[model samples]
Target: MNREAFYKLTYGLYLVSSLRGEKKNGFVSNAVFQVTSNPPQIAVVCNKDNFTSQLIKDSKLFSISVLKKDANPKLFGLFGFKTGATVDKFESVKHITAKTGAPIVVEESLAWFDCELINTFDVGTHNIFVGQIIDSDLLDSESEPFLYSYYRDVKKGKAPKNAPTFIANK
Candidate 1:
């Protein structure tokens, strides 16, 4: 099977964040999708080793910042490349705590969602966290959402090893 076929699937770039007590963390992710509309449910796939994943599991809540097309690459570098285990990602970033106590990244975000985790599924190396939308807001109606394709083609971004889209060296 050709793994390249998966590239055809569209995805949006986002910052998925959660708080473990007073400690907050976030990471860049692309494997997020709306699973239901009636009850307003969304699912985000996170690697088991990710610090943000543990925070979500502990807090049972998360926030999603829909990144804008023009978002700064440095923000992605900070969250995607650096480990939150050592770096204080939120120290310099401008964000606010959502109603669910999840950190919501404000800069260069077109929209945001605060979610209450409803269910979780272990999928090998990743966990799928399904959440009910508790709160949502549009930050920039005019800006277009950042797409995974754009990240790769325009920004020359590559998915981290833990990312669902990551293709290992063969």
Candidate 2:
């Protein structure tokens, strides 16, 4: 069977942020999705070893910033492509502290969601964190969401090994 077909599936790029005390980190992910309406729930898939995962475990809080199409690629390089253990991910970016105390990027984002972890499911290499939406807001009226297809087909972006969408080409 051909695995290349998996690349055609559509998704959206997002930055998932988490914080615990002074520890804070974020990374680009396409696995974020809305799971419910009433009470409003959302899920985020995080690599087991990601620093943000540790933060989420300790704080039980997170925020998602829907990136606009025009967001700088450098932002992804800092927040997505690199590990937050060595460097400060928020130093190079502009953000605000949510009521949940999670750092959220408000710059060039179409929208944002503040979430409280309700439950979690361990899925081998990743843990799926389902959270109850505590708050949400539209940051910009005319901003266009950055599509995963645009990252691959248009901008030629590749999924990181930890990304849920990363399937080995065997």
Q: Considering only N, C-alpha and C atoms within 3 Å, which residue pairs clash in candidate 2? A: none
The CA lDDT at 124 in model 1 is: 98
Cα error, candidate 1, residue 168 (Å): 2.1
Predicted structure 1: lDDT: 0.92
Q: What is the lDDT of residue 133 in candidate 2?
A: 93
- Worst lDDT run of 10 residues, candidate 1, spans 161-170
lDDT tens per residue, model 1, 35-114? 99989999999999999888999889999999999689898899898878998999999998899988999998999999
Please report the TM-score between candidate 2 and the true structure.
0.95
lDDT of each: 0.92, 0.89
Candidate 1 stretches greater than 4 Å from native = none
Cα distance off (Å), candidate 2, residue 152? 0.6
Candidate 2's C-alpha runs over 4 A off are 168-170
Query: lDDT score, residue 110, model 1?
Result: 91
